[model samples]
Target: MSSFAKPGSEEQELKWAWIWFKQFCAFHRRAVEREREFSADEVIAFLRSKRDANVPAWKRMKVIEGLIVFRESVQHRNPADLLPLRETMRGIVSIERAKSEGYDTIDDVVGKIDPKEPDAIQEFRRALRRGGMALRTERTYVGKLKNFMADRGLTCLADFERIGAADVEAHLTDLAVDGNVAPSTQNVSFHSLLKFFTLVLKREMGKIEAIRATKKPMTPTVLGPKEIAGVFEGLSGVHLTIAKL
Candidate 1:
């Protein structure tokens, strides 16, 4: 008989078992490493020691049977292949560790934010629209109000109420001097602020006059030949012919 086929050779069986155990460890190490935290050498050594002692022959056979079952469960299985039970346990332990450490579930750190007072700008604009202001006029007023808040770093309407006409005048002057805005543009921005403070904030902007008004230059009107011909000729072709008849 060949050396491997010899029965009752305890040393040879132990050596064969160790070889199978090493192969199992290699496969289990790869599986454990996929989990990002498990140390393969430590896990393999620990499991191998446990399997060699205290585990009964029937249980060991069942574990080996499970390995065969697992291998057969895949698309391909080799009858000659042998696998150790500890590898499967290592995979299960890795999974359990990951779950225990809270890596498995989605974190709750980003809770829902409350929609409250910070939404005042939107509310104010809606109120203005409901109050029958034209779309363009409402847009202009809201835009200026936003600019005022941005310029002063104001957070709320209450914060804006503390500002006086002097602040408004200063803002307009800054737009004219530093921004180099035209007098008409400055006047538009000024009026937009005045209207928002008076209507939306319910603040009295008493005697707040516009800085300047630019009268657009009038240009003479001209007519094209087609327009002039259409005006002079009136109806044409079949209509004209029918009318004459």
Candidate 2:
């Protein structure tokens, strides 16, 4: 029934975090009505929802830090579990600051991408530009995220809040078992999803315990007779003598 966080300083922005959390609960959830208590999953979902809504990373960091402080001083729970989230938030802030690093942003992202894309996708591209990642990598990440959304019937990024580690595992497992994708392909999809969740969604993915893709057999790398002959064809004089020796 109680809906108030303890008084906190403006310097830390803990006050604003409480305000945001309450508003988030009222709008998206009934946690406030239930107990004003939220689990790590809910918090992750909330932060991701904020990212989906185009909320700045600094504000999300404030919520995370404030929640940690609240746990320590208010609920007296261990805040160790949230430390990784803090690190992730720091990376987000760093990425936002990286726009001025002088890598090509005018065309690499702002011009090449459709302006009609979702804000989350647009932000994902901006993050890639600031990170200086290859264009191939950006496309791969976006494609993988789209596949996940398709599988889940997710129409917009805002619904990404419902996705978590379980969904990630399920999708990868289906790709391996049902779709029968190659091991390397599934592996790329796995990394692509992980990076998207961590960097774009602003959430930490838990350990994946899904069935793995089968590895394909490979031929040995020893030089063939033709290749050996070709190599000797280019050698001459002292080099040929040394090769013969």
Candidate 3:
């Protein structure tokens, strides 16, 4: 676990960090010809972009830790190259705190966004990007939020602030009961909305406790050697010719 990391936080950090590293890889792929090396300068630029986009400071730090760990453990490269990014982020974080603008995830946010998000769900997209999530993630999350908003009638001129945990639970529950989505699909939808509400919409998720989608038991298809041979023996005439051909 990382220093000062809460219990189980390191796992969460790695999860979130992988999310960031993917972005780093994407950025690295775009800006350089050879993808053989992880550059601290490139990472610094990526972190700067995240800060500019208003990703929380703690989240960006996790991103750096992920890169460091990746270099040391996965890539078997020197982790020291990323130290500059850590120091640079430290100074920036200090400046943010001195200005009294450091926003903690635990702190309650008291404002709402344009609930409609009529401009192509840009706000949600921005939130995902700022969080250093990947482009595919942005697409999936945006799709999920759009479906949730449209289904729940948040399109236009509706009371969005009143949208709460009950509404979310109802939507997910409907997907399970009515839509008959697989358990994993329902989980994806749940998390998509969870992040949207908590990170993008700045609302508390409270507790999910929604009725989960139960996966039905599946039967395996198998044929014994005798069964296969009998089937082959039965294949005469055109079937046999087609099989041979």
The Cα local distance difference test for each model comes to 0.55, 0.75, 0.71
Sort by TM-score, best first: what order? 3, 2, 1
lDDT of 3 by residue, 98-127 (tens): 345323321211123345566436666667
Candidate 1 stretches with Cα past 4 Å from truth are 1-120, 209-245
Residue-pair clashes per candidate, as listed? 0, 0, 0
RMSD of 2: 17.4
| Candidate 3 segments whose C-alpha is farther than 4 A from its true place | 1-120, 156-159, 217-220, 237-245
- Residue pair clashes in candidate 2: none
For model 1, what is the alpha-carbon lDDT of residue 104? 47
**Which pairs clash inside model 3?**
none
Per-prediction TM-score to the true structure, in the order listed: 0.36, 0.45, 0.49
lDDT of 2 by residue, 43-125 (tens): 78888988899988888888788777666655566878878898989877655644544334445533356778876677777
Scored by lDDT, model 3 comes in at 0.71
Best by TM-score: 3
Model 1: colliding residue pairs: none
Candidate 2 regions off by >4 Å? 1-105, 109-112, 215-245
Q: Candidate 2 — what's its lDDT?
A: 0.75
lDDT of 1 by residue, 23-137 (tens): 4556455442212332335444544654667654344454454434434433234524344344565444444433443334212111112245344465555565446455466
